[model samples]
Target: MKKIALLSFLMVFLFSCGQQAKKSETKSEDTPKEVVVMSVDQVLEQASDLAEKEIAVKGTVMHVCQQGGQRCFLMGSNEDITIRVEAGEKIGAFSQEQMGSELEITGVLKEVLTDADAHNPGAEHGEAEHEEDAETQDAHKVLAENQAAAERVFFIEGVTVKEL
Candidate 1:
């Protein structure tokens, strides 16, 4: 029967066309690309959840603290996530002045989750441990005071310096 043959051919062609359409739809879904801009808390959570995992974060400079004589951003906004900038070794060469201005820093997010050897586990105690909390507290107070004293409103360096 000619009608039967024609109907079979039409059905086969329609089914094949449907499959091709389905394949194209599936291909788009298969590739997953996701980028998220996380707040400090979210960034900290992600850093803790997946240590050494590469991530991107953006925030303004809240405070800059000097630990081990190198400048580090004591970064915060409404929340506090004591994230540090990568050391000079990691960032090549940079200075505290660079941090004085608003910045969009991109680096590995690291957190010291514990300091079991000392009190208040996870408190970053720099290169040496303190004998007691008071002594450590005083030392930090003094160190902070010293840094505060030396703190300048602005720093001029490199080509920015003038011959006045």
Candidate 2:
């Protein structure tokens, strides 16, 4: 009789433990994920790791590509860092008026590889080897300046935008 009672108690305790573990697992699954907000510079610095990941960023719109209205450049509060934000299919064009306005944008980070790099992967070395004339040198200097403006250039495929 004592053995039967102990066995029964052990079975009930084991079953309750299993039930608690299942409940905790369910609770974990139901927990909401924390959202991370980043500045334009942080995103630029982490672009290589964050590429293809969705993130929220805040910045001031510095320029919008007026011709297509599909893309805009955003500058952080520091002014030294800039990132490109591209309108998602559903969001449509970004207006010129949006420039100078502070905005919170949520999107996926994407790398934009230039045509030359995309087509001929080895072309970068060839371009670096070419001798530059005075005019070509000036152009190369401008390109280098642009490249130095940010650690890494990335385009955000905007999922949502709100002016702040």
Q: TM-scores of the models, in the given order?
A: 0.38, 0.58
10 residues in a row with least lDDT, candidate 2: 114-123
Top-scoring candidate (TM-score): 2
Q: Which candidate tops lDDT?
A: 2
Give the per-residue lDDT digits (tens) of candidate 1, residues 31-55: 7544354445556555546455445
Ten-residue region with minimum lDDT total, candidate 1: 155-164
Off by over 4 Å in 2: 1-32, 115-152
Q: Rate the local accuracy (lDDT) of all candidates.
A: 0.49, 0.82
Model 1 TM-score, 2 decimals:
0.38
What stretches of model 1 exceed 4 Å from their correct place?
1-37, 65-69, 79-81, 113-164
